[model samples]
Target: MFLTLVLVVGVILVWFLVIGGVCSWVWSRLIACSSSWASPYECGFIASSPKFDSFSFTYLSLLVFFVVFDLEISLLLNLPERVVGFSSFYYYFLFLVVLSLGFLSEFFWGYVRWGY
Candidate 1:
């Protein structure tokens, strides 16, 4: 009990020295050469021209489909290790049915098509 108490007190002391009390004092005493650290451009003038126009929803949608299908493929890959009983098999089948339905609906809706 005494050792645990001493260790707890030491931890509390170290915690305060690390952050609880001395950290604010140290930051308050430090100084920066320039105050532009908070600005978007600290070392140079900010550019007025816009150059971020290459993004497209087509690529975003494709990326989303890739992620969803990749996740489903991973879950399918881990089938043997995860399925331990009838309940697990039932849930797995239910999951497969749900994903297949979603995929079929997407196919019928023209979302999943050639070149896409």
Candidate 2:
């Protein structure tokens, strides 16, 4: 039993060490190959011209909200199989109400616009 535990721990440690080394080498290579220019520029285009556009806060907020909402939906979808009670429905309803409130606030603040 002791030998088995030691072997398992040793294998895990070696696996982590190998993974870390590989990740570090790849990160170093990427950094070395990157250009010195901070601003994004397209090849065959004037470097001085305005290049990459920044995402606005409205778009970012909507993206974050939708991602989180979808994650919540996926988590809740499994609840019916695992849980058997009215409590699950109550929690699901509460979550939907809160999510709706958030959507309303975002709409009022103009984070979610009509025209894409």
Predicted structure with the largest TM-score when compared to the true one: 2
RMSD of each: 6.0, 6.0
TM-score of 2: 0.50
- Which digits, one per residue and each the tens of the lDDT, describe model 1 over residues 1-116? 99999999999989978885676776655634446555656646475756566777778768988998898888878788874667677877898899889889988998776674
The runs of at least 3 residues in candidate 2 whose Cα sits more than 4 Å from the true structure, single-residue gaps closed, are: 1-54
Query: Model 2, poorest ten-residue lDDT window?
Result: 36-45
Residue pairs that clash (backbone atoms under 3 angstroms), model 2: none
- Candidate 2 lDDT over 10-111, as tens digits, reads 999999999999999998888776675433443456667776579777688778987988888797888869657886788788888888898899799876
Error of 1 at 34 (Å): 29
Positional deviation of residue 53's Cα in model 2 after best superposition, in angstroms: 8.3
Candidate 1 stretches with Cα past 4 Å from truth are: 1-54
